[model samples]
Target: MEADLEHYLEPGVGLLQDNASGCAWKNAAGKKISCAARETEALVSDLMVDQPLLWLLVSFSVGILLGKRLFRGN
Candidate 1:
């Protein structure tokens, strides 16, 4: 039974062994963080690329706010 289990899990065992020295937990965490960062960056870039008008509106609103504050002395 044990031998059969080992045989069945041979590929998994080999994969674990291969990653043992590198520490799979740290590698997995790093990969996840890297993937999340890449996805976030891609999403932001896509938004900028697809919605220039939206960005323009945001910048215009900010400019208005700043202008109001700066010219409020009058």
Candidate 2:
């Protein structure tokens, strides 16, 4: 809330309470922006969205492989 982030970094104080989501926007060459706790669901969705067709093909292949195996002896 101020020019400096001193209060946010104060000792014995929590930045995010009650499981709130927060983000820090920074600009630095070759420096990654820090983030809050990671979420598996978000990461997976990102992966799927990154290469939708590829993931679709992969899942379809697996499904066909499983179906063949399961129905082969039937």
TM-scores, all candidates, are: 0.55, 0.40
The regions of model 2 sitting more than 4 angstroms off are 1-39
Candidate 1 per-residue lDDT, tens place, 1-74, comes to 66666776757786776568788688999999999999999999998999999999999999999999999985
Kindly list the per-residue Cα lDDT of model 2 for residues 1-73, writing each as its tens digit: 4437656575533545422443334333213423222455678789888989988899999999999999997
lDDT of each: 0.89, 0.64
TM-score computed on alpha carbons, candidate 2: 0.40
TM-score, candidate 1, is 0.55
Error of 2 at 26 (Å): 30
